[model samples]
Target: MQGIATQLKETPEGQISLTDPDARSMATYGKGTGLVGYNVQTAVDTVTHLIVAHDVTNIVHDRAQLAPMAKMAKAALQAESLNAIAD
Candidate 1:
């Protein structure tokens, strides 16, 4: 308990995942429901249907993900102006 407390104190989030170091407590699409997982961001090309850019975050919410992913996809394609859509 003391060792875990020490580690948690050193952690930025003040919490630690003993099972999976990279995993985090994240909220899901359903209300009042959540899971321990990771948020994966991926940008896919329309024509090729291939993933152009990818990233991962421990963040629980995805509201701030679209713009960054769009920029990544745009930069990867080297396009002057690109259209990004998300549901």
Candidate 2:
């Protein structure tokens, strides 16, 4: 148990998964409900309806990922200025 506790302290979220080291706890839409997994963020082209930029992360909160994803999409599309829509 001490070994597991040590590992948990090393992680930013203070949790560790023995099954998948990279996986992290992610909360769902329901209260007190969550799962251990990764979050995938994608930036799709509105005009072409194709994926422009994508990323996978163990971090749970997606609210902070909007700007980074938008920038990556803009670079991938090679656009001078771009509009972003995120939920």
Candidate 3:
């Protein structure tokens, strides 16, 4: 798997998932812990608690996801504007 290793080394994150290329390593809340999986983002209705929108991404952090997830939720709801909160 030298080719795979080479490719992974070339990536900015220096990570590779053989089973699923879309999956990536994610840091955990605990120190020095991590997991390899897809980062799933979901938007739920405040009242109904039903999932309104969802997205699967390889991004390791949530900082950049707020706007995109909010936009997806807004589009799914067919709204002109949306008020969203992310934790």
- Top-scoring candidate (lDDT): 2
Using Cα atoms with residue i matched to residue i, what is each candidate's TM-score against the true structure? Answer: 0.75, 0.89, 0.84
Report lDDT (Cα) of residue 67, candidate 1. Answer: 97
**Model 2, residue 83: C-alpha shift (Å):** 0.4
Kindly list the per-residue Cα lDDT of model 3 for residues 1-87, writing each as its tens digit: 899889988988888888877789899899988999988999987877889999888999888998988988888888898789988
Q: What value does the lDDT take at residue 43 in candidate 1?
A: 93
lDDT of 2 by residue, 49-68 (tens): 99999999997898899999
The whole-model lDDT of each prediction reads 0.89, 0.92, 0.88
What are the per-residue Cα lDDT tens digits for candidate 1 across 1-87?
999999999988766789998788786789988788899989999999999999999977788999999999989999998998987
Candidate order (lDDT) = 2, 1, 3
On a 0 to 1 TM-score scale, where does candidate 3 land against the true structure? 0.84
- Which should have the higher lDDT, number 1 or number 3? 1
lDDT of model number 3: 0.88
